[model samples]
Target: MDLLRVRAARPAATGAVLAAAALLAGPAAVAQGDSTTQSDSTSPGTTQAGSGWNDDAYRGEVEVIPGDDETADMVSGVVFEDADRSSTHDDGEKGVAGVQVSNGRDVVTTDSEGRYELPLEDGMDVFVTQPRGYQVPVDEDNVAQFAYTHMPQGSPELEYGGLEPTGPAPEALNFPLEKDMGAKHPHQSCVIGGDVQTYDEDEVEYARAGAFSDLAARKDYSSCGALFIGDVVGDDLALYDSVRELSGMLNGPARFLPGNHDLDFDAESREHSVDTFRAQLGPQYYSYDVGKLHVVALNSIEYPVGDGYNGALGERQLEWLRRDIAEVPEGRAIVLATHIPLLDFADQGSDVHQVDEVAEIYEILEGREVITVGGHTHSIENLRAGDSLTGWEETFGVEELPFTHLTAGAISGDWFSGEMLEEGYPTAIQRDGGVPGVITLEARGEHLTERFTARGDDGSTQMSLGLNTPAYRDWFAAHEDDAGEAPEFESPLEVPQEDLGEAWLTANFWMGGTGSTVEVSLDGGEPVEAERTQQMQGEGQRVGAEHSDPTAVQQQLVHGGSIADRSMHLWRLDLPEDLASGTHSAEVTATDVHGDEFTDTVEFEVID
Candidate 1:
């Protein structure tokens, strides 16, 4: 119901900030009046600032501000320690003097005290850049140590609430300063996922009932945390509470990055662009360190009001990013998480949504080991080592998925529409055949291996039935008139048992209507019709969203035709049994509503 409008056409320059402003509005609007201020002096609180206010002197400070009228209460502070903890400002930990802090649009900052004051917003998160040498505290759980907890009355109520330790605000929000003690490289891992955009309560339930449930069951990530890359909800901000509740199930800390859909539609300026997102999910963009990795989450959505917007990082955020990444050791591997992919995928020439500052971001980490993850496309693409796509300046796109630049498929998969499965979720088939799921990365030292887990398959390698179009033509015409139309195809495209391999029959039956089933058989065996369940998967135009009439446009934005047509549906069937080494044949059949039936056969070979 809260859908934000995506631009119908692509912008001329992807780097223009105005392009982003023209596309979508979010919550973090820059405020017109001076920010609301709160004095910590009213209640005695610790204050620390460095010497030589005007002179170039290494200085640092911390403060806690309560929630108030003009702005929400915020307990924000910064760390001035550099990587070596020498108490000297280094490359990446340089303090960003006069940087504005806020719960949302209302902003404030530290003065000569390196101390800032402001009332926290409900569910607001306050964090400061770790000034070069100092490090913030890490909870026993290894959640990045923070300066304060602003949930005065604990986390708010919802399906999923705030962090597990629900209660009033802590006595004093203080971050003890300490040098980064030379310790063993922390054995840490962070779960990176793209687009958990739940459209409605049902989709939320689907997420809860599926991959999320699986994630909650694992205690492995109790150390580092889970970082979701954007589109938290399809269009519904209300789902944030539910998402938080689900995250509460995690064994470790959970953080979020803003995507296009996460934008507050009512947001008026760049500052207020991600207000609700920040309030519920912490900073829109922030950096943290874990083990040997320096993870930086960036806000890619540009909400330019005056000048044209581009897909690059906002000027302010970019400046902060330079400072943030500069502090890390050149040897440390950095992971950048955002919602939109920095490079083009299905659409290469369009600039309406790709990051314009790709080169700038690249320059910042020119020599450092870096990997990036994004989601907005709702399809899975692996930019392996040496892979390069069009539109990306050669220097920027040539590297293989250096550490895996994964375009995580959306959680809502094709917009949460399709055949309803027993799981009470739609079997939303993706155009590319990748199913809805999450990605897990195992990082030991500088080496990281990426694994994708589909919703129903657990940890099995994602394999879908690569259904070609020809097979569906006969099936569609057979049931063209039936209300509950389906392909008149037979079960199991017969294949020698050995050639079956580990293939899931993803029937791309362009004509199969709702409730269609495709049963498969081996040799002369009974048919095992792969169940028709609705789950979101892949990329391309989903069945329901409004699109410009195909006749009106010479080119279609998404591949494939509309799913609304009975002839436009695609289905998938997982091979019931693993294939042995050799040749095999499968017989597939489809049943139509009028009792009509159609059959087909396909053969293949599988080697041991």
Candidate 2:
């Protein structure tokens, strides 16, 4: 049978009882996708996700499973309304019809009685797709309880405790949802933060002062809430509490997806690797509907692949995705959130950094209004439809992107690596010259307009201005290793006439990409259009002094961080040699595809 045809019979409904909290205001909770064929046996190629510090004793251990009759194992569940706010299905409580439920691979909608059944196998995760107008029950830690794992025999011997033997399938595995009467708005705001990646308490505090604090102050995204996509911790699962404390600052629901660093590398089998993550976070992958948006978050890391990791969706996830998407109505806009990028402008030459099943994933999502947002790269990118990159083209035969793909820049920019700022944080600029920030997707129905909000700054701070003079380039090259102690380049506004011909004005518009424009004006004169360095249309990377953002390069090279040698949003304009020796002021304006303009000015002396 083709992988797409897997289906299971419907099952009965189950329930539990719990006290209901008051109706909450703000955005809906975090929603959390895949490629591969259907198979009864575990595929050898399907590696586990999550990574941690390597230990010699955990090397070369293979995942072992005992074969059993598929017909003997069946999972039955009910999707019911917990009337009186109790999670249990009492005499008067009724089932909710048409609710989709899944045992990972097979997707079935609840009948009028709000009951669904699916084939359950060992080591399978069963979950319900949160429908619009209802809220899933939350645990004490506020983690959603929409999923249940069934492992009859438990995980094989391994380090880092795996799922304990589930004994047998509960006679009634019920999922409870409370009716949420909050009006769904036509316009919804979704906050996206990437790679909080806090390594210790200090970095967690840095995040607190930076992006998290900014999020704490905003109340706009009460519907879609805030989603932190991957790298939640830097290989230190113990700090999950600290990360959760940061999320606690948000006004809306906060949800998370596990990153590479959030794994247990010592587990003997891939099935056991994410035990800690599952114990902390609710589910590895799940989906939810809010307003008109159908959001899907995926686990994109394949750990310990030759002692490292790669971006992929193994057989299980892929099959689940195919089935899941099948239930989605045609033409509904889909948003995918993942840890590793499906495709990105950055790391275009590295195949390992992108999903191995890009083509298949696209095929599954064909003819849909889709946009993918990912973290892990720690850089910002706004790749649009038809965008092409050499790595994607050559590696996956993906000629062009079918829709938008944006890389959400990290909250812990450059791993919290940079000079301490007066604002009580670091100036940890990203490789693409984007400062630490959160990305916002404002949608009216299926139409979305993206906006990036830099940490510790207002929305107006969308671009950076720098004079890319020969002197500045020289300064960048000389102080490559001297972070925090490098002397500031004085009189940066003054430039010798000899340096003018070779010098240029640079603007790094953090969210600018394919359809955006940057123009420079001297002395309030005509604005001369500057050229974008990286067109991102199936080309190799453009790097070095000729294509760098002098402002970010200076700070990164001097203050310890990834060099701003290449960018997808950098624009440059050469200064004319005809200008006489005197003071000159240049005004730069960056206009994004949304017709929004951000302006900045720089003044320099044309020294004789």
Candidate 3:
């Protein structure tokens, strides 16, 4: 680790960046015509700071490893410094030592000469896990290119098309890497977002104004960039360009995974299902490194199973996963990013909504510090280890989770449902009462803390509190179909004396999970602990008035959104039946797993 160097802040000029690289940056090259362009004047091949071309992966040439024979049953590769930024491993450019490469089921480290060989199988995807301070090449759309498909035969006849098989095994496959001028270590902000499912251009604009705009305004997370955990676009593959445009707003490198909605449903077979997605995004499953953290993005959506998709990883991918983790150095922090969750509080009742082989995945990650993130549920659920759910137990026989699993709330909250907001977007409250937002994982070495940022709200805003009155419950039943048409529920603070006994104060803590505590107090009195609605301890979803969040339900019922019928992050406290007739204020404080406290207040009246 002593040999590792920290990257610094970039200089304004491209010439300054080249000068700072110790002349490692080769001669200036012609600007490449890409669909998206940066605001900075730096050439695409330059490794200058603030040039917006800081990703080293974008500045290299492709080549084959020097001394390897064809017709070999083993895969050989050389990881080298792309001095010319040409992607090809030129003669003058030397091989980089101590790099980790994988063949989906086995891991090998480049020797002193920066060359490695591993047993190869047909149709296997060979890739190099990028190291810190170095970047792999990225395409015009900023999709990282680190893997090579070695399919001997092109994809079978399918609608979307699978990998065009390479006619024969190459003598050697080489990987190119450029030095990162702005890499950060020890402390990093990684963005984990979910479900930007834009069905049309209108929704694309909504995403632009909503989460994308919010992300664009933030300067943090430039190190690891942003990872969209699947559903980049709707079923229409044509909209991939629009999706790329959305990512263009990001300040750092952008990566994506595939979701059920992102599949080629018209494909004749499963192998060719994600062809268009692969052509647009990067690999279906891959890994990368930042500081001491190793990030693994897995494809969890299995299409053409029968009538619909299933949350599964085919045997090959699973085998690759086993090999990938085996290569990770012991004690390094691992972050797993995927489309469908392994086990989610939102879909604890459905078998098809979560990964089918959670136990196997858990076993692979055993004895390691890990955090898993997914986006299919369109809700925010920060579940920790030891958390158990009925669905997981019945389906995968998972007694308890082995690590933290966070279901990232969607950027297009509830598929862009609800009334339009003044911010040029919809409220789009999610099914679990969480607002549309991006999740931030602040990492300092192997330990990290997770935080949620609502689409337009400040960082401090974490939960919404309101009184669930009898009148509101009646209104919910009557306006089930009146989306964006029903009148707003007025007089939230004025509750009749008759309704005070049954009324409950509801708290919708967006990222709250097990070990979180919510307390309520009236008029600054003694705070009473509020019970969480869904314990997720092998029980069914709790719904109805006692469990539902009134604040989210109000907007969801009348404004067209996923019904807030059950929530894992919702908590309720029954109000006192014998209260003096007067106006009172209830102060609510929610403390998450990290001991971070968020306070909110709501006033209600008890009139005789």
Ranking by lDDT: 3, 2, 1
Tens-digit lDDT string for candidate 2 (64-129): 223344345777767888766556666778889998988878899999999888888877778888
Better of 2 and 3 by lDDT: 3
Comparing candidate 1 with candidate 3, which one achieves the higher lDDT? 3
Residue-by-residue lDDT tens digits, candidate 1, 85-162: 343334555443443344333345546534455555544455653332234443322233342334445433432333
The superposed Cα distance between candidate 2 and the true structure at residue 497, in angstroms, equals 1.5
TM-score of every model versus the real structure:
0.57, 0.85, 0.86
Off by over 4 Å in 1: 1-173, 176-186, 304-310, 391-403, 466-469, 473-608
- Model 3: per-residue lDDT, tens digit, 1-608? 00111223122111111111111111120111111111322222223454443333363334544333445678777898888888777788898998888877677889988899988766666888888778776666555678776666666665555556565667778999887644436567788989999999999999999888887766676667789999988887788889898777776678889898888777876776787777667678888888678899999988888899999998888988898888788757889988999888888767789888888898898888889999999888988878887777877888787788898889998899876866788778788877888998766677767888778654555677667888877877787567557677776556788987778777788889888899887787999999988886768778775677666766776667777778888888888888789977776777887776666665567887
Off by over 4 Å in 3: 1-75, 118-123, 150-172, 181-184, 481-487
* Descending-TM-score candidate ranking: 3, 2, 1
C-alpha lDDT score of every prediction, in listed order: 0.48, 0.72, 0.75
How much does candidate 2 score in TM-score?
Answer: 0.85
